[model samples]
Target: MNISSLKLDSSNTVLVTGGAGFIGSNLCESLLSNGNTVICLDNFATGKRENIAGFASNNNFTLIEGDIRDLNTCKKACSNVDYVLHQAALGSVPRSINDPITSNDVNVSGFLNMLVGARDANVKRFVYAASSSTYGDSTNMPKVEEIIGKPLSPYAITKYVNELYADIFSNTYGLETIGLRYFNVFGRKQDPNGAYAAVIPKFVMQLMSHESPTINGDGSFSRDFTYIDNVIQMNIRAIASNNKDAINTVYNVAYGERTDLKQLVELLKKYLSEFDSKIKNVETIYGPQRTGDVPHSLASISKAKKLLGYNPEYNIESGLKEAISWYWKNLK
Candidate 1:
């Protein structure tokens, strides 16, 4: 969908938790450019300052350096906000498996804190970063929002709990909430140095450094890797939509297509090779499958298309090309 068609009011104040992270920072940039007052709340545990450095000086942007685990902090951040885009949470399935307690505290408890704060503050709407991991062990192709399997890891459980809490808040207290179930989102500013970094940026960094990237499960696993701009678009639409049916429900935000790991590596090499010819020859290493990882994940974005009017502007190939260009210019 064209961004101009959304007709968002620039005078509104929007609070985006985790605003220094990849997705949150992008949202903040978009909102600020549109002349909105943007408040960013982050603890900097996983978020980096460099991601937000460029726009930090913008008059319309304000940053709150605090953890969402604190209820008071959440309340303070939500005060006088027109909309709340709650993107702060602990991500990564393996990280949750290794330390479930920390994950639950940050993902579940922190989410609850945000909900309560938003409800009490009387924000117009509360939108959050729900995960595709909530699909869990469901082997169904093109995963729909209604059909979900049992959660496989602590992270999945936490995200599912967020949905439940959102529903309860909506029903019990008359709060408006919308959940965006993001499927493998990636693009510029995505961290490539972390142990839990997503595949795209990690592979790009390894190939640029002439190191073989280790693929889990023989490179056959696939995912619906949505682009960052598309994710930003979904968030904007969620906040802008006034339809009652669209609120208080979840929608799958994706490009409605899947690319396997083997294909992903091939595409990355093809795009990155334009910057460095030797990158095409970079070999890949295969490792045992990761614990709590699903083999394939594809999303049915029909719900988002129908309800939110989401028309994704970038597919995997096009998004990867833009991402590669950014990495080459900034990191090379």
Candidate 2:
């Protein structure tokens, strides 16, 4: 079953943290499209206002300028909300390596605050952005939920800690929660400006600028680059799923297909060249692999498929096409 087939409860008021970021903003828009009231909380730390600019005038949408690291702000955001999609966090393996303490403060401490705030607010469900990096040194081909490797970086540790906190909250406080371990999610609104920007967005930006994109390592590292629409689908289903087996469980949200960095660049070039033929011959520069980076990642989404009925809507090619089109229109 495709994700579009899943049913959602439209009456719920949803609070989306980091709601101005790439995935959060997309989720907020989708929820509004489904006729749900969405309250977006973003600090503008990495989240941009442009991401949610279109929804500003919508009666069903509200934006709050705040950070998730603050308990008071989180408490305020959780009030009268039926569901909490905690997407706020300091992401990127390189960024975490550069500053582990800040990552811990935001991803771990901030996450706990949100969990506590949501529990006290009596929200129906709490879903969060877990990461594929949690499968850190595990040599497994298709990462599973039950088996996890030791976290190789501070970002990975923080995300893994979120799952731990969620479990303890469910067991001790009976606060329902779900964690979706997202693979390389990419699409529109993904910021390509920062030094720690994701591969897809950064590469897209560089290609648009007619500059050579850098490939870390030999460009052979593979990732299960899931699309944004698929992620939004997973969040909606995870929040609304009434299945007993689905609640309080962690699921891998991915396309279940891996594409190497070289292949990814080729695909991006192929698509971008159609818009500007100058990008057709842009060569890639390779650099020594950065620290805290994994060699490969793939997700086995059977758990989500069986329990939450999470069927991803787009594959790499299809998602990239959509993403590229959006960036072309908005960025250039």
Candidate 3:
């Protein structure tokens, strides 16, 4: 759980919007551990209170129960903040497809509110969670930042719009920003029992409960699965980097390797079998691939390495071992 970052050690105060969600809470936890004052702004709409329950006793941690959709709330959260990590958005491509209106209102409108608030507060840096979904249907293997295809879903559209907004804010308002295009991020504190739960956690929970997990699309679909701690590294690097060229641009935050659903399932079963041998015999059911899903996905981390000095330490196996251990002790 130890973390290190320059220029973000103790003198800075960071505003982590959506700080109760999986990624945001991890950011808050790392920042507080490093002696930085952490302000967690979340509405608990999608972010659960239990995710941040341990921090309630920490003196350096402050929780602001609010929504990003409200301009006043964004401004209030941004007040006197040295940095802004804008992570408040309705994630999931399927969710956005089901309710694009709500997604747009929260992702686009709320993002603009935070940008305006950050600009007014004169925050030093704004690092926000972008998505690999921005690549859309480019048919490109190893998606680069500059090259992106048209969006495949409503959620992809919203995230693409976020990059657009961030670029404009940097140009028009002079607000420094960095966008991290996360690819299948999974690890500890991630929700395992939601309607739109991510694949890894959801599979773990299901397999532990002796239920067969349904893999959409013959288990051939692949993703550049990234661990949460790597994501944390990228966020901190994005905040602390001094390179002017790194600012106002988006970087792929990933492990730079592709993992198919079948390989992922085998690894999960192998890991979970250590906890319960019955899990090894659990069967996987194949289902129709859902809408708005790409056949394959991966990322290019060269930009992040050269620009932000980002070095992801955990690959899928190492990360899953750590994550499964936590879930075994905590959830099981």
TM-score of each: 0.99, 0.97, 0.98
Q: What local lDDT score does residue 3 receive in model 2, on the 0 to 100 scale?
A: 30
Provide the overall lDDT of each model, using Cα atoms, as 2-decimal numbers.
Answer: 0.94, 0.91, 0.93
In terms of lDDT, the poorest run of 10 residues in model 1 is: 1-10
lDDT of 2 by residue, 1-332 (tens): 23334677788899999999999998988888888899999999998888898998999999889888899999999999999999999999989989999999999999999999999999889999999999999998789999989899999999999999999999999999999999999998898887888999999999999999999899999999999888988998898888977999899999999999999999999999989999979999999998889999999999999998777879999999999999999888
Q: Ranking by lDDT, best first?
A: 1, 3, 2
Candidate 3 structure quality by residue, lDDT tens digits, 1-332: 35554555687899999999999999999998898999999999989899899999999999999989999999999999999998899999999999999999999999999999999999999999999999999988898989999899999999999999999999998999999999999999999987899999999999999999999989999999999999998898888888998999999999999999999999999999999999999999999999999888989999999988888999999999999999999999
> Number of clashing residue pairs in every model?
0, 0, 0
Query: Candidate 3 — what's its lDDT?
Result: 0.93
Angstrom error at residue 57, model 2: 1.1
